[model samples]
Target: MNPAERLLEVGRYEEAERSVRESLAAYPSDAALLALLASILRARHDYPAALAAASAAVAANPRRSAGHVERAESLILLIRSREAVDAATTAVTLDPSWPGGHLVLARALVAARSLPAARDAARQGLSLAPRSVAVLLTVADVERAAGHREAALEAVQAALALDPGNAYGRWLLAMLDAERLRVRKSMRALREVARDRPAAPDIIAMTWPIRGVLSGLRRGLAVGAVAVCFLLAVGHWWWPQVDTFARYVSAVLAAVMIGFAARVLVPAGRLPWRCLRLLPRLMRSASVASLVLVIVAVGALIAFASSGWWVLAVVALGAVPVLWALGLVEMVGAGLDDPGMRPALLGLAGELREWWRTTKRELREAWTADGRRGE
Candidate 1:
């Protein structure tokens, strides 16, 4: 039993599963092994397997509170709400002192939408084990579902204070902040959680919009730069009449670039050398570039409107490149600010690479088919 418990505690689910299987092989009627296996399966979200294992455990030992609890958890996952409630209730009645029984009952009640009952069970479990973060989280969930946002936030905050490294608690807090439209605060909180769990889908989704915004800004700048340069260079040669307007646009663009570049590059003398040295010069450069591009775009628009020589074409030529530059800047800025985005960006790159490979493969297959048909 100690070995099995130790295996479970260490998250060696395979070893725990094997140990339970071996124990069941030696003692085919062992209800405890079945119950343990059910718990392990539940953790893996193999709810059907857990249900079968829990059912066997209960059949072997109807009096076992753990077996009933395990079955109730599986039933809850399976969406058998009424049956889960009954099983959870039975488990609590069988062993009122067992925290697991109350926890299971709380979960089942929550599933059944019986918020008050769920809260009671969670409170009972918390009383039995005051240090159980799981119980506290369950209570928080009940409070949140019951429209007690402040209470829910407090409960989650308490859990986090008890264990600052609690990823789930931090994530919940971030979600609460996001719901309240605290975009920057929510992002800051999620950024921390994303550091530990880079592959989390929710984190990726939340950061995506910010990433898009930054990318759009960068792309807008680059395109604007190239457009202004081309327009001024070519317009100066062909349409010397508008030379003054072109020079004004170019001057404005240069000033904007220089100002932003200086702002980004020139550190505030107030900061220590160590902090100043750590500033990302490349990001600053990109920010400067974006500002310059925006200024050039505005100047180009003003010139085009005043000169009135195919205004749409002139505006479009400047605007398209600026938009593209803005997008790139946004993508780079997001990656820089949220270091956690590195892995997600890498993953996205990998996905794109795979898609390219697949596309090539299909194209080759189609070409081969066309050649055969021609023959």
Candidate 2:
């Protein structure tokens, strides 16, 4: 069992499958083996085969809750939520004291968008296994989807308290904070989680949004600069009032960029040299260039507001095009405003990367062993 588990853990699916087949040849009707094989098939993403394996396990021993749980898991993987709920319910009835059954039920309910039922099922599971991070996360997901944001926050906080090193827990906490408009706290929490798991699973892939925040803002500023260029050109001679308002708005924009850049370049409680050293090198040169452009833009805006000379700001706008061409201060990434497919792809990619690493390690070990001479 340990060998099979290790094989599965390290993505040696073919060997794991072979091991299971050899074992089943000796114990053809073993329900546990059938259930284990179902799980192995699931890991290999052979969902239909996994379903068949799980069904065989259930048929082999109707009294065993493990078979039912395995069946439920396979059904959920196939997106057969209703069937999964039935299978999970059977597991719960067969073994009313176990958390596995309720966890499956909760997961199926979440897929079905039956938030109330999922929350209840998760709570039932938590009552049985009070410290299960998976069950707790499910509860929090249900609460969040049901518009109980604060409850979701509380649940995740409890999960973090239980396992502070859980990357998913920290990511979820950070997302909840982000949702509530606590940007600084969310940024800090997200950064901490990202630092811990550079290739985070799809379940907590905040890297794109978090890492691209400054870039996105800069991109936005570039676009705003273009728009302001147009507005200044049109409003300079035709609309005195328009030019006056554009000046104040441009000044505000310059102030905002300068302020945010300062925050990023210089955080409090550090010596000036250390803070400068810690600043992201990617943006350092761009930040200096942008500050200079901002100063020029501010000066132009004031001149335009005072004497209808808004055309001067247009020269400052040329810097944006240069930066954009250099690929320095530009918008990039799907960002936090994504329509929501990136996280799944990232998760899949992360799993595949791990599988590749495990396979490499196993091959290396086997090659070294083959080179050893027998004593």
Best by lDDT: 2
All candidates' lDDT scores?
A: 0.69, 0.69
lDDT of 2 by residue, 1-375 (tens): 457777988778889889988999999899988998998998877777888899999999999999999898877776677888999999999999998789888888877888889889988988987788877887787788788999888889888888889777888887787566455666577667656765533322333232233454447567766777677766766775666666676667666765654554343212222333233453344444544555565565555545656566675566566645434432222222232223435655888999999999999998888888442
Lowest-scoring 10 consecutive residues by lDDT in candidate 1?
267-276
lDDT of 1 by residue, 218-328 (tens): 454455545555666666678755645554554565456445434422322222222222334544455446545555555565555456444533553666565566546
lDDT of 2 at 17: 89
TM-scores of the candidates are 0.53, 0.53
Clashing pairs in 2: 202-347
Off by over 4 Å in 1: 198-375
- For residue 95, give model 1's deviation from the true position in Å: 1.1
Error of 2 at 329 (Å): 27
* TM-score for predicted model 2 compared with the true structure: 0.53
